[model samples]
Target: MEKGTKFRIIKGIGLAALVAALVQTGRPSLAQQQPADSTETKQDVIRVETNEVMIDVVARDKKGRPVRDLRPGEIEVYEDGVKQNVTAFQLIEADSAVASSSEAKSESTVAGGTVREAPRPLNSLRQIKLVTLVFDTLGVESRRLAQQGALDFIKTQLPPNTYVAVFKVGNRLHVLQQFTNDRKFLEKAVERATTASHPQSEDLSDKIRKSLEELRQMGAAVGAAGSFAPPGTPGLVSSGAIKSGPPIMSGDGSVAMEKPDPVRLKLIEVTLNALRFTEDTQRASQGMSSMFSLLSLIRAQGDLAGRKTVIYFAEGIQVPPSLNELFRTTISEANRAGVSVYGVDARGLDSARTMRSSRDMLVAAVNASKSQLEKGSDVALSREEVMSTDTAESSLRKNEQGALEDLSISTGGFLTANTNDLRKGMGRIGSDLGSYYALSYTPQAQTYDGRFRQLTVKLSRPGINVQTRTGYFAVPPTAGAPLLPYEMPMLAAFNRHAPGKDFEYHVAALRFGASTNGVRHQLLMEVPLKNFTFTPDAPKKIYRAQFSLMALVKDKDGRAVQRLSENFPLEGPLEKLETSKNRNVFFTRSVTLPPGRYTLETIAFDRATGKGSVRRQELVVAPVN
Candidate 1:
């Protein structure tokens, strides 16, 4: 079959399967219901979902220099004015995890290979969480210049192997890039954020005017040229009148050879396309509306529950008016996903000097135009009318500033004023990100009653102000358990490998599986040699493969109970098949009860080349009645 036909068949089948899955999930065709408390159980049991918390502490003196010597006990935590115990504490160091050079290559081989080396357990005992950088660039006049400093800061300051995602927020939020350690890719994405006409900006009018002017110039030049006679004529135009014929003349002695200039037409087309792009971007920038993008990114990163930092960049945030409720919902979602947002005020570095100067010039031009119009009309402006107009203009400027301040405060990020030393401000931001501390604690209550809980983190040492998320949304009790049972199968499908003629195929799929019975899940994954076929006559082939699988299970008190390792082999031909499976069960099994959350992780490694892949999942099991 042709590739086109094959693709169509595959696409149709995929669409049908997706529709069936949606129906099976009992979700509406047009809209799916939000995850709610299960009504099947009669007992009103609230399950609290445990989330990894990563705090970014900014310690500065009267003059802004980072103070990094603070200890764990010097910090205090409060939830809505109620003090909570700090269950975990740690000081993150540079050598937290050892890096392997050939890890990627080892994991890609078909032969079962040991991919990931075991992570050396840290002495410090702080709960780790995923951090995302939300970068907002809406208010910035030059995105390219501003993004450079921001990208440099992140690349140089963030810890190695940190799960980071980058987003640009303006009139709309755009996920410019997803979580990855590839420094080059991140830099390229940042540099690509050039200043374009945005939906909310007044500069669009100038763009439109330029487009119109170009179009007019083309029209005039085409008109000045007489009807085309020879092919090599300077102003000769293509006559689109005929389907397939030479230039045709009209009855009025005019040749039907007049056509719009291709260059101008192309320009107009590009301008129109840009306008549409701006509109789509505007819609995406709405706060919380772009959560799905973040969710998808998290899914791609496997389990985000065990990450050190998340950096957020954005220009402005327009959260819902019911901010308190919205905050709870957003926080709850982030907690369940094991992620926290560290908003990098992308707009903060932009100096207002250029924009202020431009505005002043524009104002002067407008006033001069008004004065000329009045003089030419031989009419005098009324004093009251003139005063009213001035008042209105002043109000508009004030409103713009107020809007910027509101956005900065609502998202737990600071607003940087337009200053001469823009790069200096960015450098300070980088230092703050690099030197911050992280803190995590479990709440006394396990129930999320849809109530707003205020969070306060204070340093025992005076003269230090800790900036963190104001609070998080409380999770409903019943919604804490794993809802889908096919998570493993789905993961396997995603990582399945197909073998060709000369090379053997090896695939390792990993996911943190939740267990309520304390009877730990012993996943025995096997890849039969017979399932893969290869040419025997192709040079003497030695397909040696090794891979490792690591699983870590932690209980409510943030203590690791079960840490397991398994190695597997991949080799042999179709007939003489070699199969490998690794399984380990936890002996000290205790069923999860109310008031605790558990984290599970699985890492697949190739022993041959020392490459590996990782997956993480969280499970919250409530107590049995």
Candidate 2:
């Protein structure tokens, strides 16, 4: 019940009696692993020999027909001005692409007339087309159009062998649906996105418009008065401009006036409105949160093979000067994942409305400044404020539009804007996602200091346009080095207070005693067998299941000190498989750590159904007496 106290759930402990009966003899009753310290020296010496970078290129003829027959020799790939050897090349056709594991499974007749699932071949002719639909902040009309466009695309424009997933990014990221070819499920996800609400640009711009209107009204009121002082006049207000006859001495000896000068009042009002507009403009340009959420999503798909495209739907992403680097990072991450971002302006033809409002606001501020000057007022400060506000707002407007274009074009995708019919844009995206030439080459420099590496793809033939990512940031791939895409979910769960609800499991860590290697601890997990989904292996005459068990040990400072992961391939006689329902599975992993407080995080992931549960517990290693 205390904060930072790890909750220990000791369920299914009695199932230890059934472990021997369930596991085959001589294989250890349950999963066990040698101590991590024993292999630490060997793992520390491991280094990546060569890293291959993949690039997706879409080539089309002048008339817009795909030119897929181009050979590797005809295409030249350059990285940072250095031409590199093409290591891999593949032409992915829409109809030939196979994306999902379920769809890729093939059954073959084996001995005894039994059917066996053929192992998916490596480097096969068929590639995958993975597309993600991300819906961001939208107004009512734009949301409706986006929903309709998505529904139509799913119903008609969706190409064969393409897998689509739906996601919504608001204050945080929400996965509406995972990748699938089912049209009905995708449509249902679009329906769910219809009612999803976040901050709307329309509302933010409307507030700004009202402030500009107020400024204009104040300017008009000043212009209509002819008695105001001119630039050369001695005083800012004329002798009769002030309504008050003269200052009067009250009983308290405080000077009393009938009314304040209208010119001064109007000047103050104009300044406040200009300041409000500036503040609102800054607020409107904030989009770092959504960018971070998108980065997470893209990284999750880093290991996914084939062409991955993110069709991002929103009015436009606004990246202010402060967030420019973050925006670039988003593009770089997308390129690293081989994911293209196709930005669709949900406002369609009305996309320019914000810019128009910004221009109007600038005009109003400039006119107000001119009026202040004609009234013989000290307009130096106000004029500078107006000019700076106009410049900032204009820059923000340009950056908002530029964000969409840069994110798309930099990642080998295009932007769809200024059109009411969004479905046509979706159609183009489908065609673009379906057919592409994938190529990879090792960078000649091999330096990964996080610098942006410019990529140029040239063809020997003319009249053909090649579209690919501009380049990727020089960075090491960490997805499978020590951490994996599937492991990310568990790491996230380990950090958060909320436990995973996909299933229930128990985990505990016990420190035996101090040995020559410091301290030895055993990590144990007991999971119900019913949590896993078993598939009938016809050829093996048994039902088989597979799941990945991972343990992450972190020191008191929350830094991962050791990581252990292994896959469990379980199988049993088909008739006796029912007995697994009432039984539980146990796994043990040994970890050697120094005498310090640490946390052990574990996750049991069902590979068949894609379900997982993460549990954490605290372990304290005391010094020997």
Candidate 3:
């Protein structure tokens, strides 16, 4: 929680999916995404990408049984509210489907004297689904509980052949376990692992504090009387006295003391604001970037990977206002990758006092005083002040989980909340997974126009309930597509890049220490987000800058001991970023290796332009004495 503090994490190699992503460098050029079959002809050396939009449909009957017998005609597809032709439809489950497999109707016809599939695609008959369990270390209340719940579910509830990969998202994203059906290895991973943390959220006190402030503002806007008084006024927070309140808990469980305790309240407010900003900023930068990393992971998982469900367990996720695109982009990638996310509110059901703080009692005490004052004297309050006074527990729940639920719904995944027993939720999720189906469709008249597209799924039967992915970005077909920020070429897997000045950036610090795996090193890179070229039609006050980074630790043999890749997403006020350009916008990565001499290669690439900078630093991990 403090700046410059070193976080001990079990530093190790992440899931080896970046290599597969390397081959997908840039974007798809044409509809010819797949390689030419032996039965087909190589028309040109220039490859045209053949791709298909795959959607996983989870249909359930009125009684909640998995609807395993839905036919292709019974399902409908819509993107941006327009009907699309279902090119391929089939059921993908761990068990057999009640309905028969649909005929693999080849849309190809004789073209240029050779027969080819019109969609130019892979065999989209049906695919395999791998469940990805992602734990939010910083967001969840207890990491041990998350581990235990995950392990218990795996042992008792996980179906046979259901490959699962465990990931931890704390200060950074790390693959705790590779995708495997083996429960033994996974159980060990849950037990011995350390270092992975999830989204860092402020505690209950912070939420309550924020809510109190919001309610005050709302009350002021509503022109309420004797409620919350606005700041900069005669009585509230504008006092020259600057009194700090003692840390006393009142009846309502909020900071008790007197009104306009700006000194302490502001201190607490500032701290909470910092934490909130950090969480939102990380949500856009690291959280979404990690999701992009999974596109690469899908390659290692398997080519025909079916419903790649990432069961994301977190207390809550609040996307920064300016960074909503990051969430959208993350979900779009998931749609393209056919990955469904099952979001579990780790806070769970019950305990109405969850995330409560001094703000609660503070409000009641202030209001009680205000009520007596209003009865005795004429005291007018703003509408926002009144609204702030009335802000309730529901507001906190919505504030905490609204974004998370939207994300889950957008991805056509189930969001389990209102209860503490996630094991029961996990059972439901596992059962739903058993009955999920994959639907692929080609656009009849639509073109990849390099824009965002909204997708919707519908069922023909009334009593049946179906859930599937929401939408995807319409990336117009191109002759060549630029690589995503994190995509790395295989050749650069080793620390091959020498320190050079292709771009302007700074290395804030690099510290080395001992860890469970081996010697550990942390590298921090700082960049001025304002230096980025601003895209058109962005938020009025906010701007976005995108870049990709890769770090590699290579032994003296030129073998890469560990590799780190990050696609940095920056969003904030244009003015603040410009003014604070001299200040640090830091990015950190940790690597662990056996005591040895190694080359640490760091690369920063700007996606807006293909320009980048690479630095190779020599790091020696002395034998632990």
Candidate 4:
């Protein structure tokens, strides 16, 4: 397609598709209209909930080193101000947490399979813990530092029982190395991460730049208000305000005040502000999808018992406050899934302070505007405009990095920031995970009403700092916003790509012999338990888990012809759980159709982590005699 044609299509379809994706995914509808009466507007509350919560507690000494010596008896747990019994407890070694890398390395040396499609024999959780190392080449300035960090981690810090996989996140997330113990394989993965094949972060664009540009455009439009004229007034209208007056657009996306009446100036300013808000809202809304993708990757490890950690290395991307709620929701899901996130600020020492001043940006914009003056354009800078520039510049990174730190702290991992020594940060992580206590509690309150619960873990001993998740959303197993009768999450997933880019799960469909009325399509939903974080609720020696499945069959017109939802509740003895987890969760689904074309969409979600795998397929039914 030609570039212009493609651009036109994107501009036309971006908003329509974006809204559909958000609504199908159960997010609040953006750009909802407000009643003309100011008093009629009311804010709708978003109720988020979760049942079980996992908090990773990291203890550190005065020198910021991991404190390995701490007992469950010395720790006290609380939720929403009430004390709760410590129901589950265990210790995880970075190297020996579940499976040490050393053991896996030795086994890789013995049996080698060059075939990537061949499935490796599943092993017990105690034999290995899965570590997925993601390289954020997009958000990081020092890709070399991040690469060395991973190499150093594999070469020096990999535990004997730990198996590490690699992924690179640039324009999109891609797998590098599958779970492997082989050091050489890991080093090669790290090397490939530094190549030019990685997408440039520049495509993401700078929000500060965008906001400043909006401000300049608004300023220019408002400055010309001096020549404001009324269209109906022959004297003023003849002055040419009507001729020069560009179309004014309203918040509701409707064109209003067609004539440039002096009275319309207020309406015009309101329209401009509304337009800016809508643009920002669109950008922020799209951010939620991106964040969900990252969280999905973090939770893709199936049936892997023990510690699941995603050390995300990024300078961080700024997300709007409206979207920050999604950030919290993703973290809450991670805590429930027993996933601990370690945020590695890839920028190391962020040194843009001197260059990122608002005044500097203002001066640059003024210079650019002067150059544009030759083209009959002008820029008006007001006190408010300067402050707006400053605010966007200074606060751009505050919450972005804060969100990263929130991910680390909530998951009982260290937020390593403000330093050039990536190796040292890796060392701290190694020491921390080497020896730690795993503890769980059944909250006194069992109600899963999607409310926030405060969590506090106090140490009996002094001079030792403890870290874990701050809180969790009390969401029930089936908690979610119901989609329209014709809509499902698969709609968004399939629209983006086939087989979904969110979670990691596999499914296969086989058509059974046709029946009289319709065909029986048997679907095998294969979910590897290792991809999920399993917490053994102690005292009973049972690890309970929940996996959800939803299938939708849409006709050629995209109408939902059939649908089904299944919630699989898994519980078994801890040791036996290992044997059972190695196997995939398989189930069959069927839908009957007449002679016609249709779309088959299936989604498997890890209930605890909120990660999902979506699969889409096209089906054809021939007429029967």
Listing every candidate in turn, what is its Cα RMSD in Å to the true structure after a full C-alpha superposition?
29.4, 29.8, 23.3, 27.2
User: Candidate 3, residues 233-342: lDDT per residue as tens digits?
Assistant: 22232222223221222222132223433322332333233234333334323333333333333322223444567777766565432234455666666677676777
Residue 542 CA error for candidate 4 (Å)? 54
Residue runs of model 1 more than 4 Å from their true location after superposition: 1-58, 61-63, 95-120, 123-140, 154-158, 163-178, 195-313, 319-328, 331-413, 477-625
Runs with alpha carbons beyond 4 Å of true place in candidate 4:
1-52, 64-69, 94-123, 139-141, 199-290, 353-399, 477-625
The TM-score-based order of candidates, best leading, equals: 2, 4, 3, 1
lDDT value for model 3: 0.49
Would you list the C-alpha lDDT of every candidate in the order shown? 0.38, 0.58, 0.49, 0.51
Tell me the tens digit of each residue's lDDT in model 4 across 1-625.
Answer: 1011100101122233433443442232112221211111122223334233445577778888777656556677888988776654444555434321223322121111211111222234534555667666543456777777778888887765566655666444545544456677668766666553653222211221232234344445655344432223221112322242232211111222234333233323322332233233222222223454455553343223456677777766444332344566667656766677788877777746423543455465455334433332123222222223223333454545666787788767768777778788788776655765566666777654456677899988899988777776665432122121112332334444334334455444444445786765544455555666566778854566665566666898998666554444454444444544454544444445666777666777666765566666666665555
Off by over 4 Å in 2: 1-49, 98-126, 197-288, 357-397, 478-554, 557-625
> Alpha-carbon error at 420 in model 2, in Å?
0.4
> Worst 10-residue stretch by lDDT in candidate 1?
1-10
Question: Which parts of model 3 have CA positions greater than 4 angstroms off?
Answer: 1-50, 97-99, 102-127, 138-141, 193-303, 350-398, 476-625
lDDT leaderboard ranking: 2, 4, 3, 1
Q: Residue 256 CA error for candidate 2 (Å)?
A: 79
| TM-score of every model versus the real structure | 0.39, 0.50, 0.49, 0.49
